[model samples]
Target chain A: AQSVTQLDSHVSVSEGTPVLLRCNYSSSYSPSLFWYVQHPNKGLQLLLKYTSAATLVKGINGFEAEFKKSETSFHLTKPSAHMSDAAEYFCVVSDRAGGSQGNLIFGKGTKLSVKP
Target chain B: EPEVTQTPSHQVTQMGQEVILRCVPISNHLYFYWYRQILGQKVEFLVSFYNNEISEKSEIFDDQFSVERPDGSNFTLKIRSTKLEDSAMYFCASSLWGTSQETQYFGPGTRLLVL
Candidate 1:
């Protein structure tokens, strides 16, 4: 079984400041991690995914995340926060130990609030 | 970009009533899934359908819940005798057959409000 734990339920950041959202995961094998963002009234959008390729993965909208094997973490970051970045983010992981065909497990989700 | 589309974005039903949520997955996709998220809760996987049958299902996917692909284009989730606890946002997603290793495209979701 695979599980993801998001450290924060809500995070507030000022526009133009650096933003970081922490996430940790437990998997039986090399995991495939993903970060998804959901804007108000919109479907979940893929921000980034770590598929055993590169440790540092860059995504759209100036967002990126680093997958650390030792820490079992995949934390999302951005150089600066924008008002439009305010949304709910979910950390997800799949059971690669089960051959990557396993269903995805989603974290409780963290709400990002950007204040101008 | 091809998208997974869901119908009846919002549905209001009384307890014990049956409701069916519809979805049209992307063309050429061979895998379909249904997940639900209660308000302020983590998304829970209900079932995964492939090759016209369920590949996997969770405990929440009891006999009360069912899925079907009546046509090659439409996939539907039916809840028989919905309870108040059934109110939540249900998401339908799909991915190509061999692309199970990739991310699945999700729909905007159908918000079912069981009164």
Candidate 2:
């Protein structure tokens, strides 16, 4: 079965420091991976997505994620953490087997906290 | 930028009562979807619709749940008989097309409470 695993339930970092949120995925075929961010009481915002285009995909708000097929990982990263970057992050994976819009399997989610 | 919009920021209803959640997706979006997030849980996909029909649905979406695009501008999800387990934040989303990395814009969501 296709699944996503977010290694950290919660990650805390100081402002101006690097932020790393780990995610791993398992799929039956080629995969489409995505990262989404949600603020308190708000809907999800797409941070970035990787679809066999580039190994390193950049997203909004100074966030980026690298899709490493060999490792079966798509870890999100930021060079510097900001107070505004505090939010819940979800890693999702979808199968691209036969021109289908496959359902996404999401990880439990990781809450990121940036301390000033 | 155009964004999806959901109505009734909050709705409180008794179990067994019917509830309808409305949404207006981006004008150009062709694929629409419904998802729910129970308190303290991951968001789950309920259903996906396109071309005036349901493209896919999950086990959680049963006969009691239905979706309709009555007109061109509005999409609605109706729960014929609500249950306590139905309480959650319902979100409506839309994407330009069904692709591997297509971004689905989400609505503000409606928080439903079953009492």
Could you give candidate 1's fraction of true interface contacts? 0.43
Interface RMSD of predicted model 2: 2.2
lDDT of 1: 0.90
Residue B42 in candidate 2 has what lDDT?
A: 80
Error of 1 at A43 (Å): 0.9
Q: Model 1 over residues A1-116: C-alpha lDDT tens digits? A: 78999999999999999999999999877888889998887788889998888999999899999999999999999999999999999998875542445577899999999999
TM-score of each: 0.96, 0.96
- Tens-place lDDT digits, model 2, residues A22-114: 999998887888999989877788899888788999999999999998999999999999999999999988745435776666788999999
Cα lDDT for residue A71, model 2?
97
- Candidate 1 residues lying further than 4 Å off, grouped into runs, are A98-100, B98-100
Q: How many residue pairs of model 1 clash at the backbone?
A: 0
Query: What is candidate 1's lDDT per residue for B1-115, written digit by digit as tens?
Result: 8999999899999999999999999989988999999998999889999999998999999999999999989999999999999999999988776242478778989999999
Worst 10 residues of 1 chain B by lDDT: B95-104
RMSD in angstroms, all models?
1.3, 1.3
